[model samples]
Target: MGEEVHGPLAQTPTPSAGMQKIVTKHSFFCLKGKWKRGRHVVVVRIRSDRMCPQKFVFTVGVVAFTIAITLGGQVLADRFELANGETIEGTLLNPNERPRRVWLVRSSDGTSLQFDADAVTHVTRETPVQKEFHKIVSEYPDTIEGQWKLAEWCQEKKLEKERHDILEHMLELDPDHVEARRLLGYSRIDGKWHKREQLMAERGYSRYRGTWKTAQEIELSDRAEQTEVAQKNWIVRLKKLRMLVDKPQSSDSAAKEIREISDRHAVGALMLGISKEPAFRVRSWYLESLSRIATQEAFSAIVQIAIDHPDPETRLSATERLIVLGPHQAASYAVASLASEDSARINRAAEVLGRLGVSSAVDSLVNVLITVHTAVVSDGNSEGSTNATFTPSGGGLSMGGGAKRIKVESKNEAVLAALVKLTSVNFEWNPTAWRSWMATRQSPADCDFRRD
Candidate 1:
C-alpha cells in the first residue's frame, strides 16, 4: 500500500491562509479546482478536444457577421432615389441615373424629403456646365423660363453672343418687354454691339425686316433727294443745337430732344449740324456721337476735333477716334499732331504712326522713339515716380550698339515695316528709289540722319 502506483494525477499548491477554495469538473472527468480571494481567482483546467475547437470557431463567426452587415448597408443606400436640391450622407443607391435631371436628397430626423425639379434652374456637372446650359437653352428657345435662365446665365458667364441672341429673341417675342428693350438699347450703343450692327448692315440687314421700315425706305430713295432732305433737316437741327449750346437756357428741351434723335436716328445728320456750328460743347458731343457711330465719313469731323478743339481730352479723344477710323483725313491730322509738345499728343502720334503709313514722317517718328528711350533710361532710378519708362524695342524696334556705348533708338524698323506694306499698293510708283532706300537702311551703318 505504501508504494501503490497512481496515474498521473495533478496536485494543487496550498492556498494562503486568507484565500478561499473553489472546485469544478473537467470534460475528461478529471477534477479541477481554483483558489479565490474576493473577486479574484486562480484556476487550472484539463485540456479537451471539444473546448479548444469551439473557442476558435466562435471568434471567426462574429468577425464574418460584422463584415456582411457593413457591406449590405452600403449596397442598399446606393440603390435609393435622390431628389433635387437635397444632400445625402450615404452613397447614392443608383449612380447611373442622369445627373442633369436628378436632385439631391435631404435626411431630416431620419426621414428623406423630395424637392421639385423646377426649383433648380441649373444643373452642374463635372464638365463644361455653361456650354451644356447654352445648348439646352438654344434647343428650347420658346420656353420663357429656359430663355430667361439662359439670358441670366449668359450675362453671368460673359457669353456675348448668347446674351445678345437671347435678349434679341425676348424683344422679338414681346417688343415692349422693358428689361429686354433696355438691354437691347444699351447694347446698340456699345462698341462691340455697334461693330456687330455694322457687320450685319454690310451683310444686308442694316435694319430688321419689320423694324425701322421708314428709315430703310428713306435710305433706299434717290441719292440726290436723300442728300437734300438730310442736309435741310441737318441745318435746322444745327441751328437749334447751336442756340442751346450758346444760351444753355434751362427751358431748351428741344435741343435735348434733337440730340436724342441724332443719337438714335441719324448720327450723320447730327454731325453735319455740328460741322456748321463749331461750338466747343457741340463739337465735343458731335465727335463723341461719331465715335459711337464709327463710320468713314466721321473721319473728317474727328480730325477737326483733334486739331481745333481747346479741350485736351477732346483732342485726345479725337486722336483715339482717328486710330479707330484710319481714314486718309485722320492720317493727315495725325501727321500734324506729331509736332505737338504735349505727351498725350506725342503718344497719339506714336499710335497713328504705323496706321498712317506716311513714310515721309520717318524722321519725326525716329525723333519720338529716341526721346521716349532717353526719358525711360533717365527715370529708371527715381523714387516716388509715376512716369513709366519707354522703350522703342518693346514696340518692335531693332537695336545694335557696342558695349559701354548708349544705343540710338530709331523708328526706322517701324517705318520700314509700314513702308513695305504701303508700297505694295503701287510698287511701280518709285520702285528704283524705294529699293535703294530699303537696301541702304538694311545696313546698320548706312541709316540716314537729318536734324529737324
Candidate 2:
C-alpha cells in the first residue's frame, strides 16, 4: 500500500511485501542458527503490487533528512550571532580587535559559524559574565534611548568612530531624540556652554524637559494629586534642579524655575528646593525667591541658611531675604552673624542690621566698632603711619579709601554711617554720650573725642 508522511513529527512507514531482506555479516551478526563455512543463510523475498508507495516513502525520508540538516545548520549559525538587545553565545572570536568577533558551534550537529566584529556590540570580553552584564546595563543610561542605541553600544564596545557615525545617523533620523538631547546636554554642560539647561529644558524630548513642564503644572495647580504621577513629576523636577545646582555649571532655566516655584510655594517646596541646591548662585536665587514670597513658615529656614551656609554671598543673600521677610526677627540673626570670623559675612550682617534698624543690635554694633578700631590701630601703627595723621583734629576723617576708600572714608565715618542709619529708625547713638565716655578714658594724641 502507498503511504505518505506529511507533518514534522510524522513517522516512517513499514516496508511493503515486495521488499526482500538481505543479511550480510562482517565481524558480527545476529544468529538464529550458527553459520559455518558450509552453512547457507536463509533469505526472504515477497512480491508486492504497490511499488509507488515504497518509492514515495524513500523519497520523503530523504527530504526530511535534508530539511533537518539545513535547519540544524541554521541554528548553529544563529548561535554566534545576536540581534539588538540579545545576549552573546558560544565561543568568543577575537576579543582584542577593534570590533569583537565570535564563533558558534552547534552542540547537537557539528556546524561552525562566525559573527561580525561590529555585530558583537555590547558584549564585554574582559570580565566575568555577571560583571559584564552590569557593565552593559550601565552603558545604557536613563537618558539614552531610541536612535542612539547603536552609538551607545558602539561607545560601550569602544568603537569610537562607529559610535560617532551612529550618533550622526540618529540625529538625522530624529533630530530631537532623547539620547541625543542627553548627550548634547552633558557636553554643553561640561564645556560650560551658556544656557545648557535652558536649551535642554526647551527640548521636548530631553530628560529634563519633564521638569520644566511639571514645574509649570505645580505653579498652576491649586491642588495637585499626591499620587505617584504627581510625585514622580515633582521628583523629575527636583532631579533637574539638583543637577543644575549641585554641579559647577548652573542652568539659568533651572534657576528661573526654582525662583518661580519658591515664590509660589514658599512654605515647603521652596525650602525643599533650596536644600537640594548646592551651588551658591542657585541658593542665592532660591533665598531671594523666599524673600519675594515672604511667608511666616519660611522665616526659620531662611535664618538657618543665612547662619549656616559656608558661602558668604549665599549667607548674605539668605540674610537679606530673611530681613525682607521678617525684619524684626532677622535683625537678631544679623547682629549675631556680625561676630562671624568671615569679614565679608560680618560686613553683610552689619549692613543688614543697619538697614533693619534694630535697637537691640546697638550694643553689638558698638562692640563690633570697638573690635574694628582695635584691629585698625594695631595694624596701622605697624605700617609706620600715625593714626592722628589720618584722623583730623576737629574735622572728621574722609570715609573713602582707594576705590573702596571712595566707597567709605574712615572707620569712624563707617560707624557714624551705621549710627545715622540706626538713628533714622529712631535708635540714635548720642555723639555727646560717646564723647563723655571717651573723656572718662585717658586720651592719647592719636585719639580724637571731637570726631566722636
Candidate 3:
C-alpha cells in the first residue's frame, strides 16, 4: 500500500453474459451441495416416518450432493505416489473404488491420465487451504485483476509464499503492475521495473559482505587488505633476515636482500626492526635501508625513533638520518608529540623540535612550559595516625586512615630551552607574557586582530 502507483488498484471486469451464466451455476451448485469429508463425499439416506414428498425430496438432495462432489473433485486435487518414486498431484476419478484395475485422473493441465492400480503406492489427501486455493484459481480468470484477488486471498490465509507466487504471476501478465512490483521490491528505472539488486548490478556494483559497493571501492578495499597482509609478512621476513644476516654463512646474501627492499609496505617492518634490534650494528642496517627508501612514512618513523626510542645511541643515529633526509619535515611530527600525556615524551619532542631549529615550533613549545600531573599515593593504612598513651596506661593505641592523592606541577626545562632558543626572548614559564610578546611581534598578516 505504501508503494507509489501510476493509478489506483484495477477494478474487477464485468462478466460477459455467457460467463455470468456459468458463474451463477457454479456458485449455486458448489456452495449449496458440496460436502467435504477428508477428500471424499458419500451420500447416505436414513429412512424416517415422513410423507412421500419428504422421501422424494431427500432422494433428489442426495443426487445433487453426489453430482457437486464429483465436479468439485476435478479441481480439489490429490497427490499420488508411485512405486518408482514419481509423484503426481491431480484429481482421481472414482477415488472411492478400492479394487479398480485402472486409475483415472485429470492432471493440472486438464490432461486425462490413467495409471495401473498395481503400480500406485499411496494417495495423499490435499490440505484444506490447498483445495480451496485450487478451486478459487479454477474459478477466477487469468487477468491481472483476477490474480490480484487471489493474491489478497492468499495473504488473508497467511500463505506468504503462495501470495508471492501470485504477485509474480500478475507481473508476468502486466509488467508495469505498480502495486505488485512495489510489493515485490521492484522500482521503475528507465521505464522498466528493476529490483534493487538488479539496478545495483547494472550500475557496476556488487554485493560484498551484505552491503553493496561499487567496483572501484571493492577493488581499493581488497588492495588495502592485501597490502596489510603483505606488510605483516614483511615483518616476519625482516625478522628472519636479521637472524640470517648475523650468521657468517648467510650474512652477505641476507644483507643483499635487506638492501634491495624497496616496497613502501616494508617501511613498517623496518621501523619495527630498528626499534627492537638489540645489536647496534643490526639496527644500523635497518636505518640504512630506511634512508635509502626515504619515503615520507620512513622519515616519520625515523623521527619517532629519534624522539621515543629507549636507546640514546639509536636515537642519535636516527636523528642524524633525519638531518640527512630533511629536518623541516621532522618539525611537524615533533610538534604533534608535544601534546603527549607522557612527561618524558613531551620533553623528548621539545628537545627534538629545538634541535630542528624551526621557529614554528615556538607556538606549541609555549604551551607545555609547565604541566601539572595527578599522582595517586595510595596507603593501605588510612591517612590518620594515633599515638599510644604513656605513663600508667596499660593499653596501647595505633591508627591509620585512607589514601591520599597529590598533584605535582613540573616545569619542563627542554620546552623552556626550545622556546628561548627560537624567540631569543625569555618568558620564564609565563605563557601569558610569551603569547603577548609573540602577538605584538607578529607580521601584519599573522596579527591576531580582535576587539573585546
Candidate 4:
C-alpha cells in the first residue's frame, strides 16, 4: 500500500505450455465460472489424484509466497515520533496475521521497536511530493504570476481544490481581478446578479449539480412515520409558530402542518408565517416550505430567511437553496458564511466559495490562510520564523488530488485550493506571496462583491 506499487502478476512469469493449459482452465472454470480478461493464474501438474490435492495446496502456498516477495519489502521508510523525544524514520510493517498484544514496528536498518500510546508522539507516512510543494510555496510566496500560472493549469486539469487555493492566493494578491471573480462565480450583469445558466449553458463547466436534491430525494418514503401534529386546524399551526424561538415545543407540529399544506395561498401563507414566525424551528420549516414551493417568490422568501434567521443551520439552508437556485450568484450567500467563526460553517462556506471561484473571497481567504493554522512554532523565536526561502526538488509545476478530507490539514488544503481558484494563481502555499501580490494592485478590477 506504500509508494512502491507492485502489480499482482509481476512475480508470475509466463507459464510453459503445459502450465498455461492448466492455468487457463483454472481461470475459466476453477476460480470464476467464466473467463475474464487480464486475470492472472498459476498451475501445477500432478501424477496422481491423491498427490494432486496435496501438490495443489503447496502450489497455492508457493504462489502466495511469491506475491509476498514481490509486494513486501524490509525497507521501512515511515517516520515515527516518540514520547522520549526520539525520532525514527524507516519502513514500518503491520503484519495483521496473528493476534498479539505487543505489536512490533521494525526499522529498515535492522532496528527493532514497539509502539505504545504513551511512548509514541506521532506517526506519519513519507510524502515527498507534499513536502516538495510546501517547499516551492515557501520559496516564492511573492512570485504571484508563477503561482497564478500553476493555478490556471490546475483549473484546466480539473484539480478543483488546488485550483481554488491558487485562485484564493491570486485574489489575495489582486482582489479586484475580473477573470478570478468570473471564474469564482462572481458574475454581475449591469450590477445585477447572474447565475450558472446566466453565463454558461454547458453543464460540464459547472462544478456541482443544479438540482442538489432530485424529486425522489425530496419525497418521504414513509409519510406515515411523520410526527402526528394532533391538530387539523391550519390557523392553529400558524399560532404555534408565533411564539418564542428557543421554546419551540409547538413549532415542530406547526412545521409539519405547514410542510403538508398545498393550496393556492400556501406560498403566501408560508411567506407570511416566515416573516412572523418567532421560533427558529418554525422559521427553518417555513424556509423548507419555500424551497419545496420552488417559485419566484420562494427564492425571495429564502433570501429573507438568510437575512433574518439567527440559527446558523437556517442560514446555511438558505445559502444552499440560493445556490441551487442560481450558482452564478452562490457567492452572494457564501461570502457571509466565510466571515463566520464556526469551523463547520466555515468549511461549508469554503466549499461554496470553491465552486463559485469568485475573487470577492480573496481577502477573507487570505486572512484564513494566514491566520487559521496552529503554528508548529510560536512567534518571537528565530527558529520559528517561516521567512526562509525554499525550492522544490526537481522543479516542475504540478498539483493534484483525488477525494478531499476536512481535517486541519484538509481545511488548510481547501483554503489553498480556494485561493488558487479565486485568483487564477498558484501561490502553492505562501501567504506572503499572496500578500505581496495583493499590495501591488492599485487600480483594481470591477470584481468587488455587491448584492442586488
Candidate 5:
C-alpha cells in the first residue's frame, strides 16, 4: 500500500486502476477465502460424540494453531507449478521467507492446500511472464519459429549476442533464409555474394525500403572489412613493402607509399625492411620510407640507418629528410645521435642540425672539441699529424673505409663546419673561443650572429 523512492532508484509508478482492481480482488479472496470455506479451513466438522470434552478441545486448539501458523506466512499472491505440470495461483504461505520443501497456498475459491515444494518445479518471484518465455523456449529450443521469437525478444531487450546467436541458429536450419540475411544485412547471389550497400546500390528498390539497409547489407559490410583485414596480413604487407621499396622510383615514390600506409602491420613491414634488407640500395629505400612514415619508430630506424650504414649518400638523404621533419620537434633524437660514438651517426646529426639552422649545436660542438681535444689533438699540429687513443667513450673516427684514430683540424672541418654553419660563427680550432663566443653572444641561441 505504501512505497518510498530512494534517490538512486526510480520512483515506482502507481498501478493503473484496472491492475489495482484485479490485485485487490485477488489479494482478499486469495487469502481470506480458506476461513470462509468450511471444507479446507479448520477440519473441525467431525463432531466426536464418543470423545471426552477435554480431548475435543485440545484437538480443536491444535488445528487452530496449525492454521494460524500457515496463515502468518502468506503473501499477497504467488503461482506454483507442481511436478505433474499443474499450476495453482493463490495467496502464498511458506514457513520460510523463501520457497522450500513445503508451501501452503490458499486459493480464491476459499480452499487451502498444502503443497510439497519438491513437487513444485517453479516458484516465480518477479512475474509469470519470465516463466512463460522459459517454458516456450525450453519446449522448442531447436525450432526455427521458437528461436525466431526468442531472437526477437532478445533484440527488443538489447541482448546483442543472444539475438545474433539465435539468428545464426535460424540460418543453420534454413541457409536460404532471406529474412535472417535481411535482418543481419547481406545475401549471397549466384554463389559470389555482394555487400549490403553494393546490393542495395546495384539495384534500385522502392522508396519504401527507406534509409535503413537490411541485416544482409550489414553482413556484407562486415565481409568487406574481413577481406580488408586479410589483405593487411604482415606477410602480405612485408612482400608489398619489399616490392614497393624500388618501385616507380626510389626515395620519392617509396616515401609516398610509406606515408600512405596506415596499417600497423604495414608499418612493421616497412621498419623490418629498413633494418634487415641485405642490399644497400634496398635498405636505403626502406630508410627513406621510414623517414616519411614520421613516427618515433621511423625516426629510430633512420637513426640506425645513419649509425650502421656506410653509404654517405643514403645517410645524407635520410638526414635531409630528418631536418625537414621539424628539427626542434626532433631535438631529442639529434641529441641522442650526438651522444653516440658512431662517427657516421654523429656527422649526420651535426649535418641535420646545421641544415635545420639549429644554432644550439655550438655548445655541443664546443663540448665535443674540449672532450676529445686531449686525445685527438697534437702540439703545433699544422702539419696535420695527430694521434687519438681509441677508447670506449670516444669511438675512433671513420675515414676512407677505415676507423682512423686521429685527424688534424685545419682551422676546423666537418663538425665545426656544421657549428659554424648553424651559429654563423667559427671558432676555428679554439674550443675555448667557441665557448666564450657562445656565453657572450647577445642574439638568441638559434641566431646566426657570427661575423663570418
Candidate 6:
C-alpha cells in the first residue's frame, strides 16, 4: 500500500556509516547515530504526510519532532571529578574535542564555565537528555509558539528543568502569553498577572511546609511544636528525677525541683509520674506539683485521678485539689462520671460533686440517686428430681433440693446525699420529688417545700 512511499523523501549530508534513518508518512521517523562522546543520538520526528518540507526545516506538524540522546553504557548524569576530590555535575558543552585540552559546561544558572584538563581528574559525560535539549534549542525557533512546542516535547520526555527553562524563555519572548504564564505559576489578579510568591505576599500568606498559611497560624503551629519538644524533654528529665526522688539521698533536691516547676508543658510528664507512683508520699508530691502548675491539662489529669484512683483517700485528695481550683469545674467533671456503670464510681463522683457544692449538678445527682443493676442469683436447688432410698442392713440415702434465685435491685446512697446537700432539702431516696422541686424552682421562680 502506502508503506513503499513512506520511506525518506530526502535527507541532507547523506547519513554516514553507523547512522540509521527511518521515515513513515503520517506516522513517525526514528534516526539513530553515535556522537564523538560515545553517546547515541536518537531523533524522533513525528510527521504528517500532508505537510511539505521547505528547505531543511524539520518542523512538520502540530506535534513536530523530539530528540532523545541515550548513553552508550547506561550512564545517566554528567560527573566531573576535580583533582581536589570535588565533583561537579552539569551539562558539558565541548565533549567531542580531538585532544580534549579544555572542558566547558553550562551551569544550572545558564552561565558558561571552562575548566583546564590538568585540574580535572576524570569526566563522565552521560546526561543524554541535557545534550539533546541543547541541540534541539539551538535549531528550534526563537518565537513563543516555537518555544512552546519545545516545552510540550520536554513535558513528554519528563525533562522538568528543561521545560521550565523553555517556559521562562517563552515569557521573555512575550510577557503576556497566557498559557506560559499559567504554567509558570502566575495568576491574573486585578487585571495584572502576579507570580505565586507575589500573590501569596499580597494575601498575607507565608509558605509553611508546602502550603500557604497566615502569620497567626504559623505562630500557633510553631508554639505547639515547641510545646511538644518541651514536653518530650520533660519526660526524659522526669524519668531520671523519678529515680532520684525514690532515693533518700537525693529525694529532697528532686522534690524541690519538681515543686518549683512552673512550665505548663511539664503537666503531661508530671501526670505520668503521679499515675504510676505507688508511694503515697511521692504521689502527693506529684499532685502538689500539678496543682502548682494549674494548667487545663493538669486539672484534667487531677480529675481523672479523682475518679479512677484505687486509693479512696488519694481520690478524695484529688477531688479536694480540684475543688480548690474551681468548684464549677469539678462539678461539671463529676456530674459526667455519675453516668458510669460502676456503682462505686457513681458514689465517688457523687461525693466529689457534693463536696464541690455546685447546684448545677443537682439534676445529675438526682438521676443516679438510685441506680438499678441486674444480677444473676442462684437458688439452692437440685438440677432434676429429688429421690430418697432406704436399703437393707441399716443403710439409708436421702437427697435435698436447692432453691432458685432471681435478679434484685440496689440503691446508691452517696447520690441521694449529694442531692440533699446540694438543694438543702432532704428528698431522701425520692428522685421524683427532687426533680419536681427542681422544675418548680426554674418555672415558678420559687422553692417547692412539699415532699412525698
Highest TM-score model number:
6
TM-scores, one per candidate: 0.25, 0.28, 0.51, 0.25, 0.37, 0.57
* Candidate 1 TM-score, C-alpha based: 0.25
Candidate 2 structure quality by residue, lDDT tens digits, 1-452:
13222321112234454543322211111111111111122122333336453331111111110111121111111122234333323333344564334432222232222444455444433234322332343234332363356455656777554355445445555655655646544344455443455664666423332454444565444355444355456556666775775465676666667767643333455566666666666666667666766666567668767656666677667766666577778877667776664445555566666656665565556555533311122233244553332211222334333211211222333444564565342223454554445456456522322322
Q: What lDDT score goes with residue 310 in model 1?
A: 54
Sort order, lDDT high to low: 3, 6, 5, 4, 2, 1
Quote the positional error of residue 81 for candidate 4 in Å: 96
RMSD of 6: 16.3
- Estimate, for each residue in 1-452, the C-alpha lDDT of model 4 and write its tens digit: 11222333223443332232122211100111111112233223222225443221112111211111111223234545555544433345664525434334543333233444455466666465433332243233344576566666556656565466666556667776677767777677787545555455433332224543333443532232232232234345555544432366755664566665554235656766666656666666767667777766666666655544556666667767776776545566666655554444555566556655566677777766633422122234343333211121212222223212221222456667777776677777677888787767542532632222
Candidate 2 — worst ten consecutive residues by lDDT sum?
A: 28-37
> Residue 346 error for model 3, in Å?
0.6
Question: Which residue pairs in candidate 2 collide?
Answer: 93-102, 398-409, 399-408, 399-409, 399-410, 400-405, 400-408, 400-409, 401-405, 401-406
State which candidate has the highest lDDT: 3
Distance (Å) between predicted and true CA of 280, model 3? Answer: 2.2
All models: lDDT?
Answer: 0.44, 0.45, 0.67, 0.48, 0.52, 0.65
Candidate 2: deviation at residue 29, Å? 40
Per-residue lDDT for 13 in model 1? 40
Candidate 3 runs further than 4 Å off = 1-193, 379-405, 419-452
Candidate 2, which segments miss by more than 4 Å at Cα?
A: 1-105, 108-259, 263-288, 292-324, 342-345, 372-416, 423-452
TM-score for predicted model 5 compared with the true structure: 0.37
User: Mind giving the per-residue lDDT tens digits that candidate 6 earns over 270-353?
Assistant: 888777878888778778888988878888888888888888888888888988898787777788888786778888888887
Candidate 5 segments whose C-alpha is farther than 4 A from its true place: 1-236, 240-259, 278-288, 306-308, 342-345, 373-389, 392-413, 450-452
lDDT of 4 at 41: 30
Which of candidates 5 and 6 reaches a greater lDDT?
6
How many clashes would you count in candidate 4?
Answer: 39
Displacement of residue 332 (Cα, Å) in model 3 is 1.1
